[model samples]
Target: MRSPTPPDEPRFVLAARHMVETGQWLLPHRGSELYAEKPPTFMWIQAGTYKLLGSWNLSFLLPSLLAALLTLWLTWDMARRLWNPRVARYAVLALFVTLQFGLMAKRAQIDMVLVGMTTLALWGLVRHLLLGPSWGALALAAFAAGVGTVTKGVGFLPLLMLVPWVIWRWRHPQAAGPGRSWKWWLLLPAFLAGTAVWLAPLGIALLQNPDPALQSYAKELLFKQTGTRYANAWHHHQPFWYYLQVMFTLWVPGSLLFPWLVPAWWRRCRRADPRYLLLLGWALLVLVFFSASPGKREVYILPMLPALAVAAAPLLPGLLRRTGVRWVLMLYALLLSLATLVVGYGAVHGDGWAQRNAVKRAIDPWVLPQVGWWLIGFAVATLLVIAVLRLRRAGLAVVLTTVLLWCMYGLGAMPALDPYSSASRVMDQVRERIGPDAELGMVAWREQNLLQTWPQATDFGFKRPVAGQWEDAARWVAQAPERRWLFVLDKVMSPCADRSQVIDIGSANRNNWQLLPGTALQADCVARTHGVVDDADAALQDDGD
Candidate 1:
């Protein structure tokens, strides 16, 4: 079985799959305009992979893995240039084990690719700062910025790191090479070229079509989405301190080190250490930028995590030796071990314990057999922590614990959680019941659901005639000559109460759905209009009788 599709994965996968299947280079989602939202670089990459692998799941996940590997390698290379070999290795491990980075890397999302591109851009800029401005490094930095801008609007945000770089360079004019003449300005054109390669064609096409929908899409993507998000946001609106809350949870054990590391790094920043200043500036700029936005998500600040890891690498040896830090590590390990034991007990005892525990209640009863393996994995992690604590190997303890937890999550928890998290199972049911070629429609269901589940169905794009009502869908089906199926929330089935015409197939993702025979829809229409019949016509019929 395919692993479950996460929240937005289906959208990206279906959009790219459509492009490949229909030979439409533009992304045409059900609700959104063609080519609306972020540029399709990530989707295009997924489409290329799907062509090669013939597996949607593999194609969706491959880019994230590749981007993660690239980020890790780039982090190590950059660390080595700034510090020693030991620090470089630590930087790589720290980045790989960071909870947010690890989780983001395993999913099919544009965020990881955006993070990778921006990291590359930062690396190029840093190289120029350290080794003097070279044509190749400047060009690479500019190109990465442009490509990133197209990937996600925030991709170019990392280019702000150059401000600190320039200030530092000017302060130490000896470090600023004479080559920094007009050549430095070439970066802007390089950025424009990278973005134009993707946007120019689409812009020309939009000019030719000029459909209101297309124009609205371009306007929304280019202006409204960003402006509305920053001002009076439409979604995910939170206080300005939202990222501050996310940092505590998302960064995990890596963030545990931040309390001690940030202060020391701040001291270095004051001393004008160019390396510290560059990394500090990058992380702060990203954090403040996202924090200032009215709309926020935890993953928006992912680009900063690698910079934080690199900034902390030099301090690891010293921090690891602190007694206070070791105590904190031990406490964290102990809490994790206890949590694992509780899960094991719940898994073994079933619903009795699950009734009392919120975490255990969420696990599907069928997956309890896998709980033994999870216990064993957590046991090994706990033992490693004890051994490392005794041996005073703090770095080893952190790395091994992170690896064990990551493995348990990937191998154990993910499989158990798949049914609850992904729509793949629901999609499978649809395929089995309707057959691949059957036309299907959606009523108040997300566009992602229909496209991901039944991409082959011809009736995929029927819009609701009225908001929050299935009457439009009923009317559409009534007018059609062939039978049709609709996926809708179970709560919305009141309008289709007549069981004879609307046959309930089954329910998935907490939504009820049914197949509507075109012939029976006329009856449903009459049933819905029962209260509107004229009383005079009924009296005339009685007089005739």
Candidate 2:
């Protein structure tokens, strides 16, 4: 079963829904002139899937799942090329159970696609380095980079791993193999050629149209989004240490083993183990690149996980044999069990703990009854850890423990959290309040749930006229003879208090919504203006006739 759609899923789904419904690839709610923030590759893929499946439910997730599988396969292949088959198998197991990978792989997002593409690129580069620089491998690597670039701007960032690899190659000329230096130079042209596959069509279409909206999209995609995110982030701003914190917590059991194994990996790198150097370079470059960005999200570091897994795979055998490592694994399992107990207690007993805990707050009261299942899962995982440790199957213990926990969370916790995480319930209420066909506009807030639930509904998107200046939806609403129905957040509804009859819809993301009539909204706007004018006569005079 699929888990509830997270906060960002609806946004991508909405965009894809628009493409399917209206045959428009751009973001419909972002105004007619505004293009989507990211390239249309993922959305287009989602649209195609939705079209084929005739169901929106699993359509978006299909791409994510494919990307995840590709990532796993590529990681395995890279590990195999770099080390032995045994190490490759261990690396795949380690990667499969990683918390970040498991969580992201299940989501309907582009992050996994980016991860998959970068992994492919890294694999291609490693192939060229280890098996001699074949033109085919160089082209594959460069093309992956270009395609990944179109997927997300940071796709090109993985190519930076080549710097360290090149440096190492120069230091030890004998390791350069039979490849000529000129073959390496072909990587640039191949990348540009691959990129042009998408860019060429888009550029021609823009030139043929030559509209402001298309131009705006081009500028934003090429410059504003990338430059602004790095220099001065508009959203999700965090300190450099943000990812460091994520490594410790969000990375989970794998992270517990990372610190123990990293020193050895680095020592191997110094000894010029080509595989170690490649994996190390891939992980460090990706991590440092994302960390340097002012805008940070835990998911941004996902591309590094495969590389880290490969780098750490070599030490798994020795580490598993150590008594101390087994003890540490046991301790980790105990902590997980303790957490499950505390959360289960909090779920059953009415306490302020639910309010204080982020995880608890996500679940609906109805789901509390099912909390026992989650606890059961944790207990089973803990017991399995002990059993596996006893059998000296340390790697299997890690995989089983992590997978069991995530499976339980997906089956029990996710469905329970659906009420808050999704807007389906709220949209039903909205439809009941306003007849299904009534035009709906949003003021001062945009909810992804709204778009996903009701794709056909008109979106005004904070288009309330401030002075006399009017935008698209505001201009249309103002001029229309028919009454308009709008959805406004509680915070923005204060101005319409007496003029409009506000019917409370549900809340999500800490914001409440109310359905309001258009006549009341107009009256409120006029009254507010009149009140402002009454306070200052000079201000009224300046408003002109």
lDDT per residue (tens digit) for residues 389-456 in model 2: 65466556667777777777767777666666675556677877877656766654444545544545
- Candidate 1 has an lDDT of 0.70
Q: Report the Cα lDDT for candidate 2.
A: 0.70
Clashing residue pairs for model 2: none
List the lowest-lDDT window of 10 residues for candidate 2: 536-545
- Model 2 TM-score on a 0 to 1 scale: 0.88
Against the true structure, whose lDDT is highest? 1
- Tens digits of per-residue lDDT, candidate 1, 340-426, equal 777666666664454344243243455664754586567666776766566366567667777777777777767765654564455
lDDT of 1 at 11: 64
* Candidate 2 ranges with C-alpha deviation above 4 Å: 1-6, 26-35, 176-178, 355-364, 384-391, 462-484, 494-500, 523-545
